[model samples]
Target: MTVLDALPSVEHAAVLDESSKREIRRAILTAIAVPGYQVPFGSREMPVARGWGSGGLQLTLAIVGPDDVVKVYDQGEDGGVNAANLRRLIRRSEGVETTTDPRQATVIQTRHRVPEDELRADQTLVLQVPVPEPLRGVERDMNELRRMHAEGDYSKMWVSLYEDLVRNGVITETTGYPCLVGGRYVIATTPIPRWDVPPLHQAAFLSLFSAGREKRIYAIPPYTDVEPLTFEDVPFEVEKVSARCRCGLVVPDGDLQSYQVEIPQQDGSSVWACSDTDWCTRQRVEAGLLDPSAITETEVDL
Candidate 1:
């Protein structure tokens, strides 16, 4: 029996038809050919809710093959409800191997956070985007925004950013900042935190951003320039956290600082632990930090 036939009815609903898959694949090929150009596609309705990462899910289904190892993350946590649910859906429908480790995966479909580990050349990052249009904030009309992108008219966006820097001494836009890709079209990346922005600049892996709600898909080809919109005098800055958790995870370039925990009645004390579940688990295994006997059955599912 085929992979889809093996899944139960509820899980099978996640699978898109062959025609839809073909169309998505064609769009992806076109996106890769014209890097950074936002290619419109007929986004298929997913089993999941529209705003809840259906775009990333669709991309995952389209690119995933029987031999590929998939990884899904929601805000850097792979074991979270959203991530786990998507993982199960893909596994059930495609019956492909899945992984929590970024290095092991061929395709990683993520929401709002890239992994701390740098992805390999063979990996693909599928980012779920809420609004694909970078000019949505400046120009309300979609047609006008398309025209602005087509004509390379981004003076208004640059002016607003200049005004913001003058007023606040920094760019006010925090997440999903506009970026010029391959020195041509400006595209809005997924609403990832500023900390993840630098990784997009000539990244090793191919990056794909899909917006199911907006019905748009774009790509940043491997080794392509992805410069965040900024002035030369005042460069873009990523947020740096120095708080050292008791878990012994060290930031190579970050300074060591105390991490405090809130308690009911006792005084707060410094401790260190990883906020990223997958990274923490990987580290624990590598460092022999975790007890193998304590590993539960659920933990072995991945």
Candidate 2:
């Protein structure tokens, strides 16, 4: 028998040791203390790669409790490969309830996109960040980036936006948009689409960001001001989905719901549906259009 198989079976409820969990908890406390400021921590090795939701896994595992109902998703699909695997990890933790419904989840971890449903104050949204620094594009040196944040000088980023507007005729930036948080720090809301950026502003739920590759954790507390960087005349706009969802729901451009082309059909006409599968299912079920048993967890790649 293999060495692992030969050993007596053992059950461990928590993933990280108490010492490590405590350290992560301390860092999260500080991240909340200074909203939008990235706080570095000792990132531990995980079964998954660093950039692909490892950071988020750490954050979820660190704070998850016996009573917490956890939800994990990639681009809002609960059954996405990344989400399923991460959920598996947490579900393995004894007494930690897991659910697909955002309304029931106490802690929801996400990558790339936010849920279509409005989040409540009781929930904690943990966002996985591939790159934690907002100034990384403009400044290469870490010291300079730190100094820029400390001095509240973000002229370089402003110039970058100006250049983007001048050259592209419009701000082509969509995902990973930079936003000003608490009117003090410019934070990188990486991987989250422009459509998802608005919910971070004056949000009822606490938002936490973790980047394992960069070993940084940041936070945006409830009801904080989060403004997207934009010119005075050119107001920020989210992406437009021309087609109505397959469920016959058509929200406005900046609505909380996000749309994605449903599995491409042979007819070439793209079919759109809510990216947040659980939310869509719940909506239809509530409307009496879909049966509760008809709900299926769909697998998607972010």
Candidate 3:
């Protein structure tokens, strides 16, 4: 084939070829068929760097169509640098409509946090995963880890949590809590804080996770079971925040101050304003704090 036929045209940089997308779609279907099972795929390198969400972009490219509306978020904000760049890239390639509103999106690609709004049954969520294996820290070797997964040998994982409970008086596996999926494989959601984990349990929308660097993809279908590992007596608990947002939204307040103190904001304020930029802004408008027309990307800094 000629060079022109081999590579994608600059005009169509956002969308992959039909055959390539079909392969990814097939892999995604297989993953969905077998919930919590990590299916390996031929992860392509995108223009963006590896750590900046190449996997989630690939899934978006494969599933996104001209008619579908997409929303991209990093740490619950779509206006952030990473999310904006990815959204631009996707738009450039597919010429698809994009939105900050979660309710309007057909597909939502997110890193580190799920949207604060309840996702509908028809919506699809693509999660960018840094590490898909829940047993990675416990067993470094891939072969041994696979063997452990096959044998359901998660004793090491359980022991670690038990130790944490013994020392801290609570299971301190806060974010990326190792969860048992479909009562089978143990999979950890990528560093999404504990507050977001509960939404995954029997969620209405289909949740798909892709780790591009790791070359693994997994899915949790709508209505699937996702239970965080914890003893019956010592039940799992989410991180609690002390205060509500000024707009009357239940947001992380004092506890978040500890973690967000290091992040320098554009206005020199702390990053504890709102985790979900769109949600917070909507709440503000609903509360008549700001006019709908005044809402802009820069107004709310996540």
Candidate 2 residue spans exceeding 4 A from truth: 1-13, 251-257, 261-263, 266-269, 296-302
lDDT of 1 by residue, 166-245 (tens): 89988978679899999999988768877788889989999999999988889999999999998888878876555544
Which parts of model 3 are misplaced by more than 4 Å?
A: 1-15, 246-248, 251-271, 297-302
Residue-wise C-alpha lDDT for candidate 3, range 1-302, written one tens digit per residue: 73223445455654467677888899999999989889999988777788789899999999988899999999877888889888877776777888899999999999988887889999999999998988887889989988898888899999888888899988777668898889988888877888788899999999999988988899999999999998989878776645455445444553222111124578886434567878877877886887998765552211
Worst 10-residue lDDT window for candidate 1 reads 256-265
The lDDT, on a scale of 0 to 1, for candidate 2 is 0.85
Winning candidate number (TM-score): 2
Error of 1 at 221 (Å): 0.9
Q: Under the 3 Å rule for N, CA and C atoms, how many clashes does model 2 have?
A: 0
Query: How far out, in Å, is residue 181 in model 3?
Result: 1.1
Estimate the TM-score of every prediction: 0.87, 0.91, 0.88
Residue 188 displacement in candidate 2 (angstroms): 0.9
**Native-referenced Cα lDDT, model 1:** 0.80
Which pairs of residues collide in model 2?
none
Better of 2 and 3 by lDDT: 2
